[model samples]
Target chain A: MYGIRHLHLRNPGSWSPFEELERLQASLERGGVALGGASAGPAIDVWNEGDGLRLRALVPGVKPEDLEITVEGDALTIRGTTAVAGPQSGDRWLLRERASAKFARTLQLPFAVEADAVKARVANGVLEMELPRSAAEKPRRIPIQTT
Target chain B: MNCEMKNGCATVAEPTVAKATPACDVWEGEDGVHVVAEMPGVDAAAVEITIERDVLSIRGKACLPRASSRAEGEMDAVATGYVRAFHLTDTADAGAIQASCKDGLVRLLVPRKQPAQRKIAVSTG
Candidate 1:
């Protein structure tokens, strides 16, 4: 129940929009939930709940002091860069496969999030962020008076 | 192959995972270089980090238990293994390499051999 809720699908010119949307919908339905296509960025997971929306991005090798999180209107953007200093003079390698560069991703929320209450934390290599729901968006209970 | 080094260093083989690629924090002090890599689902014994001269190599397999348990189903969010490698410089000391694994992270320390100091004798002709 506590997993990705939306996944954004792009046309990518290989498939029609209708076909893409249908596949996306089917995948979500088959999984017993949905994450709209607009949420799947590199190393990222997006979800929603009664509280509002949450986004988690896995960015290893990056320090918390190096990240930047920003929200404007319905869009949320995360950006950061990682750098590795050169090694010693005699180290040789057989195979090297790891990504290192600047990264940026933007996402749209299903409902308006209280931007003021959004929070982010980086542990290990995962970046977790939570956006609270607006006061007006929260559920309210009405009083019933017996006549 | 064109080895055009970028970022003020000689280029090695380019990495394949272009976007959102996993990286490691490398610290080079007077004695050694410390490398901390994020390798989720990988065990301490399973990982192997090697350095020869100036090239540093990292290779491992991350396996998820019960990954093949389900025979028939939608098979959503299946776990898979990962293998990554890197080429480093010769300054990394191969003899004092130390590594540790914690919470799916692998930390490696490669010490550098200090150059021996020698004095030259001057003969007056």
Candidate 2:
């Protein structure tokens, strides 16, 4: 048992209770109170894949019709509404972590984008987009010959 | 103070280990107690619910596309999941709790038990 535990300690990918606490602390420091404070933007992640750039946003309960995705030049913007009905006369709220508000966020991409070819979809409360690079933006190669 | 007020009362404190708490909204209403959690990558088939004693727990596993394998079986993408637990009061019919998931949202409903009323026969001496 001790040997296995020691092996886990050496594995960087393994999760530990201390690391979880540190992660929680780090998140709290990065504006934890912004959540549910009125009009907080949804969490978004954008990454560069080999074929194109991919972006995803966390917007649970947001109907697809309510989301508007736009890409201009190298900037991408997502706008949506998240609404959780308030408690009625006989309803008593215990926890209100989720909120009802309009959220909008824009992020700049690292390279030129082919806005016309961008594809976007929302599913299971998540929005995903595939952004291609413009043909003219691709790097041109030069060849040289020695006599 | 009604310490026994259980149905929709949140557990005393937020568990510090809520790595991805999956923003939740819990409420108690005439219909029942409802718990809605926002779990981005989770699907209807990926949710799990369990009950023990007075506690009810919800866990959802988000499914990500196969991570790009780097050198030596190293994965580039890590899955982040959502988990939370609640304490159910006697007023809730734990046996009849219903849960549903859509597009990445999980909603749970625990029906409330109406206060039982009884009539006692009068004894004439």
Best model number under DockQ? 2
Clashing pairs in 2: A124-B103
**lDDT per residue (tens digit) for residues A6-113 in model 2:** 001012234475976986674444332233443546666566676557777777888898888888888777777887765688777777777788776666677778
Report model 1's interface C-alpha RMSD after superposition on the true interface residues. Answer: 15.3
Index of the highest-TM-score prediction: 2
Per-candidate interface DockQ score: 0.05, 0.22
Global lDDT scores for all candidate models: 0.51, 0.66
10 residues in a row with least lDDT, candidate 1 chain B? B1-10
Cα-based lDDT at residue A113, candidate 2: 89
Model 1 error, position A118 (Å)? 1.3
- Give the Å error, residue B123, model 1: 37
TM-score of every candidate relative to the true structure: 0.46, 0.74
Per-residue error for B78 in candidate 2, Å, reads 6.6
True contacts kept of each: 0.02, 0.32
